[model samples]
Target: MTRIAACQLAPVPDGLAANAELTADAVREALAQGADVVILPQLVTTGGVLEDAEQARAVAVASGHGVFAAWAAACTARQGSVVVGGFCEAGDDGQLYNSAAVVDATGLRAVYRCAHLWDRERVVFAAGSAPPPVVDTAHGRIGVLVNYDLRFPEWTRTAALAGADLLAVPVAWPAAQPGEGGGPDGQLVAAATARLERVAVACADRSGPGWTAGSCIVSASGQLLAAAGPGRSAAWADVDPEASRDKLVAGSSDLWLDRRPELYDRLTAPRSTSG
Candidate 1:
């Protein structure tokens, strides 16, 4: 079993210094509390929403090295723990991408660029071209996702098919939206996905003016193992990736082995509006 910590952070807009300090502090606290891995919210270095694209682009950091190196060093000194968190990334082509980096005592291991953008994010940040990578760690084989990516089932399935045991999601979900005004919280979506993929999920959501602070950890059976509310909060869970190997929901109903991929060809075909 891996001890997981989901940290709910409130990042100040454009305040990289304050945000970084808070994130580092949270990691230390979680480790002290016996957590083997810690997950933080998306765009944590620069808050969720941005006023100006140029200013947002300025706060983007490299995938690894620098601040990440410092975090790795701290982890190494503390007997080695895994840290997964999101940040604004300065891409090579002079654009910005919402990126999540994985670090441990061995230093930076993997980075997942957010492939899906929501609302005004499309105007400010470029959608990543690469898919989320399943990375190996001391705790387990971890996959990663950003805020809007959770709405896509295909993406999560891709991660599961890639042999990921845990999915680390960093999100900045709004408090309320236009259509579905009142219903289950954002974490429910995560819970359902965890059940469908049969993998543990750790979601770290932000808490601020326009965001929801529902941070949670779900078990492979789609159970809500731990959760937290607004402000700076942390949720803990003990997960075993091996539990997801049992794909049988009932007698002869295997999850992966019973797939009908031949009939789902239309899912990948181009759509037409005139139909």
Candidate 2:
């Protein structure tokens, strides 16, 4: 079992220095608590600045530079732990993506771009066309599904089918979006976890009235393990990847049941001209 921690923070807008410092503080806190893996919210650097694309791109860092690399070194020095956090990337083509990086001893492990950009994100960031959940870590196979990926069941299912024992989500879930107010994230999270019984960590920004939307971690059996609200707070969960796989094979552990794929496909099928 690996001890994991999620940092849910209210990041200051465009304050790169302070943001990095605050984020580092949370990482240290998680390490102090014996976390072998720590996950942080999406867009930790510049907040949710969808209006200013250039500014967003300016803050974007390459895989091996800046805060992401620093965190990786810290984790490696501590105990060869893994760290994940959302960020923007200035690609070689000069386009930027809403990305999340998996950090470890050697530096960045895998960088995932947000495939499903929500609302105004399309303007500030280019949509990532790749599917998620790359299983390339020392601890075990872990998948990354950034914010807005939560709205689609197929994304999570795709990861589960691809052999992800654990799924980590970095979100900026707003307090008032849809049924999100008053623990809606928990219910949605439980339902999603129940679909593919893998330990999931959804680290969200403590945003409301403009940014950050708290965070939560759910067990494989649709149970809300821990959650945090607005402020620089974090939560810890012990995840057993082998046990996660074992739970799926146990049948009654609530992994991959009641998934009505045929029904969805039929509904999505285009109407025939015969009508």
Candidate 3:
């Protein structure tokens, strides 16, 4: 069983130094709790919802930023431990991207940029063209996805197909308004995604004004193992990543073997105006 911790934190806007320490501390704390994998909220190094592209560019850091080195140092406390967190990335191509990095004792392992932008994010970030990366780690094959990317089934399916045992999601979900049904709760969406792909999922959400503090860990069977309560906290759970390899859901119902990919051509086709 691999222990996972989803840390929900309130990052200080534009305070790189402060948020760096905040995330590094969270990693150490989660590691102390025997967590093999620690997941942090989106834009953890820089609070979410930037004003414009210029402001985002000002705060964005390359994947090689020292903040990740801090996280790597924290992971060194526990051998083979892993950390996944989001940040504003200053891409080598001179564009800003909302990206996440996977780090372990060895240092930064992989980086995944958010592909599906949300609302104002489109104006601040350039959507990534590459699919979510599945990193091979000592704990397991970990996949990553930023906020808004979770809403696309095809994207998550692509990760599962790439042999990701667990999906670590970093999000800053917007809070629902009074008298408004907040579509589907982020936690519920995480659970549903796990159930659909037969993969475990850990979502670390941010807290603050206009955000939902929803952090949770779900099993491959879609069980809500642990969830953080009100305010800043961490949700802990022990999941069997190996169990996800077994695609057999029931007697003869094999999740992967029953796929109908040939009929999914329209999934990538342009949307039709008239049904």
Candidate 4:
């Protein structure tokens, strides 16, 4: 059983130094609770929503930023422990990106830039062309995804196909409006995605104005293992990453073997105006 902790935090807007210490402390606290995988909210190093491109670029840091090093240091407290969290990245290409980094005691393993931009994000950060990366860690194979990336099933499927045992999502989900209906709940999406891909999912969400503080962990079987309700908190769960390797959903019904990829050509095709 691999213990996972999804931390819900309220990051100070544009406060890099403050958020760095806050997130690092959260990681240490999660580690002390015997968590093998510790996940933090999106843009944890710079808060959830930035005012504009200028503000975002002001706080953007490179992948080699000391904030990731702090997370790496926290992982050293627990053997084989891994941490996944989001940050505003100053890409080497001289562009800003909403990105997430996978770090462990060995240091930063992979950094995935968010491919699908959310509202106002497209104006601030460049969308990543690369697919979500699956990092092989001591505990398990972990995949990284940022906030809006979770809304795209194809993107999450891409991660699962890459043999990710667990999907670590760092998000700053918007709060549901009054009378809202038919909208995707972050927790519900996590559960459905786990069921569809047969992979465990952990989502760490941030809290503040216009944000939902819903952090949760789901099992490979689509069960809601644990949840951190409103406010800053941490959700804990013990899941079996190995269970994802079993593609058998039922007798002779393999999730992977039963795929009809040949018919999925349209999934990558250009959008059509009609039909």
| Candidate 4 to truth, TM | 0.95
Off by over 4 Å in 2: 178-181, 197-199, 207-213, 247-275
Residue 102 accuracy (lDDT) in model 2: 85
Q: Candidate 3: worst 10 consecutive residues by lDDT?
A: 175-184
Q: Give the per-residue lDDT digits (tens) of candidate 3, residues 1-275.
A: 89999998988989889999999999999999899999999999988569999888878999889999999999999989999999999999999999999999999999999999989899999999899999999999999999889989999999999999999999887776221333228888888999999999999988777777778899998998987755758889999989889998689998898899999998999989896
lDDT of each: 0.83, 0.71, 0.90, 0.89
Point out the worst 10-residue segment of candidate 2 by lDDT. Answer: 204-213
Candidate 4 C-alpha lDDT tens digits along 1-275: 88999999999889999999999999999999899999998889998578788999999999989999999999999999999999999999999999999999988999999999998898899999999999998778999999889879999999999999999999888876321323338888888899989999999988667766778899998998987777658889998989988889689999888999999998999988796
**Each candidate's clash count:** 0, 6, 0, 0
Alpha-carbon shift of residue 222 in model 1 (angstroms)? 0.6
For candidate 1, the clash count comes to: 0
Once model 3 is optimally superposed onto the true structure by TM-score, how far is the C-alpha of residue 189 displaced, in angstroms? Answer: 0.8
> Lowest-scoring 10 consecutive residues by lDDT in candidate 4?
175-184
| TM per prediction | 0.92, 0.83, 0.95, 0.95
The clash number for model 2 is 6
lDDT of 2 at 187: 41
When 1 and 3 are scored with TM-score, the better candidate is: 3
Which predicted model would earn the best lDDT?
Answer: 3
Worst 10 residues of 1 by lDDT: 177-186
Candidate 1 lDDT, 23-74, residue by residue in tens = 8888888888888889989988887577567888778887753767766765
Candidate 3 CA-lDDT value: 0.90
